[model samples]
Target: MAHNEKLALLIVLPSLLAGCTSAQMNMLTGKRNKTYNDVNAPWVGSTEEQLISKWGPPKKSYTLESGAKIISYEDMWGPISAYHVCVEKFMIEKGIVTKWGISNCPTRIKGSLPKDTPIPQPTL
Candidate 1:
């Protein structure tokens, strides 16, 4: 690769890594919050049954053709307050979780709803 290209990568890569680290720290410290579900509370390592017990039933649950379990939780953001959906894909193998992911998620979900405004009912 050209010298300029290599130099740019060296500068850009560290900046990108630093940005991600800061975001992660903010998330952990609650300095930055993600409005999906609850910023103070997020999905953690727990059994499917435990999750259900706490969050109540998910909006949608399905087994993929490959047998992955996908559970969707509906949340919202903004004044006109468009509906926002947060789906966590659980990778279960042999009845145990292998991994999970947040799909199509933004860096943050913001809302201006009243404190008394109930969480939107999931239309799943």
Candidate 2:
């Protein structure tokens, strides 16, 4: 109604709309990632079949010389113009999960590696 109020809305509305568009774009492009803190604890000692049933297939996976399997899933957030990503990794040995880690996610799940530790890079 007031001139000042109208001016404020003109400035703020575009920024709000821009943020929504960014999020939507990320989702459509498959750039969005989701974390599962609740499932971390019970995952340890679970078989590969169990992990797949709960979290679905991983986006990428690796196998080490020791026969350990590393499975990873990533999640992304923020506006598509400047998005950030986080990855969760599950280590399975002898068909059972032994440990897991997360990278760049805000909340730390139990059994995650230290924050300073680099995220594991897949060799192949």
What tens digits encode model 1's per-residue C-alpha lDDT throughout 1-124? 9999999999998777676754465654555543433432334446677666766777777787887676656654334556555464544443444455554445555533334434322122
* lDDT of all predictions: 0.53, 0.70
lDDT value, candidate 1, whole model = 0.53
* lDDT tens per residue, model 2, 1-124: 9999999999998787677743364555554322244445457779999989977999999999999999988889668998878787889899998888766765533333333434333221
Q: Which 10-residue window in model 2 sums to the lowest lDDT?
A: 115-124
Reference-based TM-score, model 1: 0.41
Q: Which stretches of candidate 2 lie over 4 Å from their true place?
A: 1-38, 108-124
Q: Quick one: RMSD of model 1?
A: 14.9
TM-score of 2: 0.54
Position 20, candidate 2: lDDT: 71
Q: In model 1, which range of ten residues has the least summed lDDT?
A: 115-124
Can you give the TM-score per candidate against the true fold? 0.41, 0.54
